[model samples]
Target: MQSQHIVNAYDQELRKLHSYIAEMGGQAEQQLREAMQAIVTRDSDLAGKVVREDGLLDELERKVEAQTIRLLALRQPVACDLREVITALKAASNLERIGDFAANVAKRSLALQQMPEIGLTRSLGPLGQTAGEMLNAVVQAYLDDDVDGALRVRDRDEDLDRAYTALFRELLTYMMETPQRITACTHLLFAAKNLERIGDHATNIAEAVCFRIRGSLPEEERQKGDETSFAVVSPGILGDGPTR
Candidate 1:
């Protein structure tokens, strides 16, 4: 039947959209992992590679957007089909942002490498690793279409937020101890914050997966553990304090 043929064609297009999203998710994951490794090892070469690879994510996003537009125009998908298309569009946007954040961490790594060593960098390794782990789990959650898995990923964002807050306090202590460490600490601060944001974006993607599966947003308020904005920092004897 001609109608059956049309239905088959539309299904194929949906599959293509999902394939594109999966590919983009994989790339975003790799970028975060490499960026974190570059920061930990102070490997400028690896950082440069991450910077170069970001363009790939950008291109993939554009492709997803273009394909989604075409599907909307041609298929006029309804209900579940519409939700699948919308989720793909939203997931691509979040993944692209995550890629940008990873690139930022890489750039910060390059900058921090030129500065004097500070003790705070030790905390950064674990912080970045935790963010990467969150990303990996979210990507898997999306692929599995497992709503429970996605909810678990959303919950894990709190862990990264707590790690970031602790790192923020330690970095302030370093800056207060010696004015000479401000420059390096500042760069480390940016890198750690970027990693934290990456975790948030992964959570966003997880929420998208949930919405796609459940056809509604989660009924409960998403748990948030980030305290960077309200964390209190007393003035150091030298007149430097952390305010974020």
Candidate 2:
């Protein structure tokens, strides 16, 4: 009977962790959508909603932190349960950062609305879509402990990088060709840059998930110029990637 009680308690704790991660993931996803929409439509009201919800992200972070402490204190989880807790700790942090990125996008959007438009303004919207979609894959990967799926998430990071680079170059061209648009273009530049960093954070979470599963860091996913001299990285660390 005592053993059964322990099992039930453990299950409940695990469910709580799952619920928190999911809640944060849902919020981040919504932020990305709304932030992009706010910028695209210049809807300050939508921007306001995104700004207001930043607190929710902070709240979720605290909830996850408290839960991790409880798990460490009372449950003393071993093996898979332990791994889940640790992954939850890291994944929640990533989700929180993603939320901030969304808010940053909204803030930039607010500034952008005050300026005249330029051609390159449309670029970050699709990039946000790509990043948000990858995030969905990441949340699922964490839920199911799917390392393969996580690797796929890493793969998409390359596409996001390419998109950002293209957008950056195009915006640079605009600034060079028509110096009058430089002010709006610079703001747009910052927005695109933030979105690009958000994609990096998503990839970072995916890498951490890979690490938690396979017990090693996957450095190969770090791109070519990435000077991290670690073998366990790449798909090998996650047990899947370019080589495998």
Candidate 3:
């Protein structure tokens, strides 16, 4: 009877964590849009809002982590219960990191507001759209426990990475061709870099979904690792060149 009670509590806690993760994910998605909008309109107020919301995401992460740990300890969960606990852990961690990235983008938004406009914002629109879709897909995957859908998102991250690389080259081209555009272009590069990382984290959550379902990582890791070109891009200097 005690074990059964613990199991019920564990299930309840998992439900709570699921809702929390969704809520946090929603905030992050909105933050991404708002950060972009801030850049669009040069709205310091919008940037300030995103920065303030980061704190809420950080606090919610603590809540989710505490509950997940308690479930792990009291339930001695195995099988599905174990998967829930671990997935919640991974999801919470990634979501919190997403919040930080949002704040970073927001910081850039504020900086960009202070600088002259380069009319380069249209280039980022598609990148933001793709990332937003990836975020939505990962959330749905977690909710539906749809491993295939999650895997699809995992695979699609390569597209975002490629888009980012193209954007990096374009920004470099702009900076090299027009010296006056350097400051705004550099800030735009960092903002886009943050958005790219947001997609990567979403993909990380998708991988965690695989881990949750299969109790181990799937073949995607090997396939993703096989790519040799990112190797050419040094990890040094943010691999997109200096943040300056």
Candidate 4:
């Protein structure tokens, strides 16, 4: 009876840990969504709300850390149970970063509001949407213990990277063509980069899911499609001043 009770108690602790991860994932997703909405609508008020709410994610991460530590010290979980606890730690860390990047997007939006509106801003919507979707999908994969789903999310990150690269080139072309719009374009560039980073963190979460299930990280090197560092945008490529 005592052994059964101890087993049940251990199971309960694991469930609580899982619940913390799920809650953190949901909060991170909502933060990214709201941050994107603030950018699309140029609502400083909404941006401010996102910034204010970031503290909640921080608190949740703290709880995850505390819980994991207690489990490791008291339960001494091994094998799959050990992997589960470690993966939760990694996922919480990645989710916290996602929340941070989302907050950064919100902060950039607030800056964008002070600058002249640019047509390039519209291009960011697709990038942000892709990142948000990846995050949501990866979170679901983690919760469902779907290794295939996690792999799919990992593969989809390249798509987000490609989209970000394309947008980066466009922003560069626009800035080169119109030096006067540099400030506004710079803000947009930062905001777009933040979204790109969120995609990366989502990918990290997907990898954590794989580790929990497979007991090893992906053997193959993860692919990367971001080429912004090597991208060269010539003013002559467009053959004219930027539209709008």
TM-scores for every predicted model = 0.92, 0.87, 0.87, 0.95
Q: Which one is best on TM-score? A: 4
Candidate 1 residue pairs in backbone clash: none
Over the stretch 81-134, how does candidate 1's per-residue lDDT look in tens digits? 778778888889999999999999899889989986665676787877777777
lDDT digits (tens) for residues 143-210 of candidate 2 = 88888889888888878878877676566666656778788888887788777777787787788788
Q: Mind sharing the TM-score for model 2?
A: 0.87
lDDT, residue 58, candidate 4: 88
- Which should have the higher TM-score, number 1 or number 2? 1
Give the candidate number with the greatest lDDT. 4
Flag the better candidate by lDDT, 1 or 4: 4
Scored against the true structure, residue 13 in model 3 reaches a CA lDDT of: 75
Clashing pairs in 4: none
Quantify all predictions' global Cα lDDT against the true fold. 0.84, 0.79, 0.79, 0.88
Runs in model 3 deviating more than 4 A are: 1-4, 222-244
lDDT of 4: 0.88
Could you tell me the TM-score of candidate 4? 0.95
1-244 per-residue lDDT for model 3 (tens digits): 9878877877787788889989888987888888777777788999999988788888888988888887677755569877777888788888788778878877887888777777675678778888888988998899889999999888888888788777776677667667788888888888788878888899889988998888887673423322323533323424345333
List candidate 2 segments past 4 Å from native.
77-80, 219-221, 224-244
Worst 10 residues of 3 by lDDT: 220-229
Please give the lDDT score for candidate 3. 0.79
